[model samples]
Structures are given as C-alpha cells and as structure tokens.
Target: MSFDPAQALRLAHDTLDIEAAAVLGLKRRLGDDFARAVALVLGITGRVVVMGMGKSGHVGRKIAATLASTGTPAFFVHPAEASHGDLGMIQPRDAVLAVSNSGEVDELTVLLPLVKRLGVPLLAMTGHPQSTLARHADVVLDSGVEKEACPLNLAPTASTTAQLALGDALAVALLDARGFRAEDFARSHPGGALGRRLLTRVSDIMRSGDAVPRVLPGADFSHLMREMTRKGLGASAIADADGRVLGIFTDGDLRRLVETGRDLRALTAREVMHAAPRTIAADALAAEAAEVMEKHRITVLLATGADGRLTGALNSNDLMRAKVI
Candidate 1:
C-alpha cells in the first residue's frame, strides 16, 4: 500500500487540536483544592517531593524543576524507588505531590502507607477523585481530561499534558504567593545564560585600575592615542588636570579627524575629544550599562566614580564575554 502523506499530516493536526482542547478544558477544573495546595507548599519550611510513575514521572520531574527555580524548593522521586528505600528523601516537614492518571500505579499504592505514616501532606493529581490515591491525599487536583489525543485511546498523551499544565499552575500560584523575583530565579539557575545576564554586576566584570585608559584633557592627541593603544580599549577618557573626567575620544574621532585632514601629531586632545560623552556609574548594574550602550548605538562607554573621576571603561565586547547580552 502506498503511504498517504496528506492523511498523515491531517492526523498529526488532529492530534494537536485534540490535545490543545484538552488542556484548555483544565482551566475550569481548577478549584479550591488548587488554592489549598499552594497554601500548603508556601507554609512549609522544607522542600517539596514530587513522585510519579512512567509518563507521569517525566512530567513530575519538570514540575519539580520549575517549582525549585521559581521560589519553592522541590525535587522529584521515583515512585518505585520510594517503595524500595527512596522514601527516606521525604522529610516530615515536606509536602508530597503525586501524579497518576488512573491513581492506581502499583508503586504509588505501595508507598501510600509510608506517606501517611510520615505525616507529610499529600497532594494528588488524577482522573478519578474516587480512586484510592485521591482518597489518601489531603488535596486532590483533578487533571481529568475528557479523552486522549491518541486515536487508539491507549497512549498517555493529552492526560500527561493536562497534568503538566496543572503542575505549572501550582508553581505559578506559589511563585506569586512568595513574591518571587528575577534575582531569586537567577540564583537557582546560575549556570544558565539568563543567570549570567541578571546576576553579574558591572564591578564583577569591569576592567579597573591600570587596565583603565585615561588621559588629561590638555594632553595632546598623540598621547591620548598612545593610551588608547596601550590599554587596548579603542578609547581613552579625557580627564581634568586633577584627574576628573572631561569626556572621551575614540577611533571614530580619529577617522573624522583624518577625513578633515587635521594632522594628529599637531592637534591637541581638546580639539578632537567629544565633550560630555555619556557615562555610567561604576556601581550601576552591567545589564543597565548594556541598555545604555544599545540606546546610544555606541560601542564604548566610560565608567566613573561618584566624584566624576575616571574609574574604568567598558566596550560592547566585555558585555558579550560576560554573557550580559
């Protein structure tokens, strides 16, 4: 038989449509139990334990990660492992979130007695409220979907999506309740690019001290160019005789002066320097410095201390190296 590409495409589209509808239906399913679950998690001083089996386990692991990154401290434990010896990971102060479509996963049922004995609060997400797992839980989040996207009705597709969405709902609710901030998220994800962008400070990545390029305002153009070359920052700060900043001169100025046929050797720094160039405070965040650079469409900016003395210089490349961009 010839393969029907058009029919396969139609089937794929149908599956996506059904799954999207299933997820949308869960919005109305949210109720007081969801609020209670959020309260239970927020009130705890310890971590949250998420447990599930098979497809549910995959969803559980992601939920645990999202919760931990947002504000709530949590992790996932395999249900079968809990039956063996992993139940020790669940502390009395912690709460347990269990995911099971039929609420009859053998491993979960075996671990139910241990969950109850430990006095840990249990939150259940299942299709059946009358199921044993639901009856055992302190709060039941009904993730019931009318049908699976799988045409054969055997594969766990839409049901798993519903469970994942419900878990996110729980995480977002807890995040708002805890007043979670971007810095808090960055702390949990320090190795990621976003973490570097948010957590890194200007002081952490800026070049200072001898690395800074600076020249007195009255210094000749030749001396300023020498400082810029020696420092390798493409620019040098024009400072007052007392070492307070005046402005900056860069390669762009050099190009303009060349076009005007001004002899660099004969010209003074004051003749070619930009007056009152935009500067950032040394204490300002590196991310903020990046924003300023982008807004001005300039590649180089001078950093100054509170006294308006040249502190350091930042180039666009520094931000890229720090992953602030």
Candidate 2:
C-alpha cells in the first residue's frame, strides 16, 4: 500500500548509522575488564565454553568457531541446555564467555550459580554492566549500543553486530598472543579450499608412474603429440633413458612449429621441445603449483624429484578439479 522510495532510503541510512555507532562506540569501551577476560581465557588449560540464548547464541557459536580455528580451542554450549545437564560441559579448567544484551538471560542466569560453584571464571558480554549476569561475572565485556537498527528499536540488530565484532576482536587478540600461524588455521580447516592450498602437497595431487606423459629425445613430433593426447596434460615430458627430465614439448610448441612452417612429420622431439621448462617438485604444496602455473603462463607442469628426474605431472585442469584453484 505504501511504496515510497524516500522512506526506504531513509530506513537504509538509519540502519547504517545505528550499526556504525555501535562499532565506533566499541573503541571507547575497551578497558581493564577486556584485558582481564583475555588473560583468563589464555591461561585456561581447558577449552573456552561460549554460552548465549537466541541471537546471542548465534554470535556465541561463531565466536567459539573463530577461537577454535585460531588455536584458542573453544566450543558453544547453549544456556537453555546448560540449565539441564549441559553445564557439565564446563570443566574446572575451562573459562566461560556468556553473551546477553540485557545481561540477564534467564537460561544463562540459571546456570550462573552452578558455573560459579565449579570455580570456572565467567566472562560476560553484555550492554548493561549493572545487570545481574554482569555483577556475577568475573570479567564483563561492554557491548553497549546507543540504539537498535530496527525503526521501532525493538529488534536485536546493532547489538548483535557489536557482540559479533567484539567476539572477533577477542579471538584475534588471543590468536596473536599465542603466535597462531596460517598453518594452524589450515589444520582446523582441512576440508576447505584454503586448507587444501596450504596443507596439500603436489605429491598428493600429481599424476605419477604410468599416468605421466613422457618421450625420449629421439621421439618424433608425432610420438610427442600422441603422448600429450594420451596423457591429457596438453604436453609431454622429454626424458632420458634413466627418466631424468631433459626438456618439455607442449601444445604451444606444436603451434609455434606449425606457424614456422616446420614439417611436424619430419620434426624430432628435441627440435621442438622447450630446453628449460618451468617445473615444480612433487613435494611442493598444491598452492605453489598454482603459483607456478601463473608464473609460467602454462596449463601443465612437470613434477620433478630432488635428483632432477621426472616423478609426476600436473595441469591447471587437475588443480581446478582438485579445488586447489
């Protein structure tokens, strides 16, 4: 009934303003309590148990994932379930980070006494420092916001964004303190592409043995073409009797030879092969293989051993299918 563009634009601007204020306000709130919270979490021998309800619960799960992936080792435990037997998930060596906008989530408050009784250090992320949960917590992280992004100011919008950002800050700070590296991140994300790039070696993805396309220096251009086609790498490795790579002949070489009016039927592998082709080690990372492909501007690469012998071969298409790209 009412489709005013002006109203829509006004609401969008209001949403941006609210969220921006919430994030900007975060700088002024970073105090001794935030430092103490980080220190407690860093010192804990057990995992960090993150707890929250509703929107806060979503933020809590993400915080836990970030912490775990960054080497802090954390996981989420819903406050409602904690009131049942899930509180047992919190061990003595563990630290707790509970999130609630009002600082008085019923489920969280119910487990506060039990958590305190277990001697677990409690860290509260909340808008109200004077509220019950904050008063009970050993450390309170201020996530107060001036307003909500919703026009009526009833929905949890800006508050949840502020909480999520604050959680990220905590996770990053701890990650830096522990000297967590990209290798550590890769370890936690082995199933992801980034993890594959950082962790999977060329040896793990290259075609070896009978799958490799190779030819001797005496082989004719026809043999090279057949080898390249059979191997499907768009190239054939030129190797010695001992399997040591000497050079490489690719589809590009075939084109160049044809353009030069050279007779393919009369040309030898040695006449058309690139004398020194770019190659990578089988033990090198697949990420490095991708980089090599970019550097050489080629579709295929020969994998060599430390002895300079051809061990395997890989191509851009192989990397794509492996999701290394």
Residue clash pairs of candidate 1: none
Model 1 per-residue lDDT tens digits across residues 209-240: 88989887778877888899999998888888
Against the unseen true structure, what C-alpha lDDT does each candidate score? 0.88, 0.91
RMSD of every prediction: 1.4, 1.7
**Quick one: best lDDT, which candidate?**
2
TM-score of each: 0.96, 0.94
Best by TM-score: 1
Cα lDDT of candidate 2 equals 0.91
Candidate 1 runs further than 4 Å off = none
Candidate 1's displacement at residue 73, Å, is 0.4
After superposing candidate 2 on the true structure, give the runs of residues whose Cα lies further than 4 Å from its correct spot: none
Q: Candidate 2 — which pairs collide?
A: none
Worst-scoring 10-residue span by lDDT in model 2:
255-264
Error of 1 at 100 (Å): 0.4
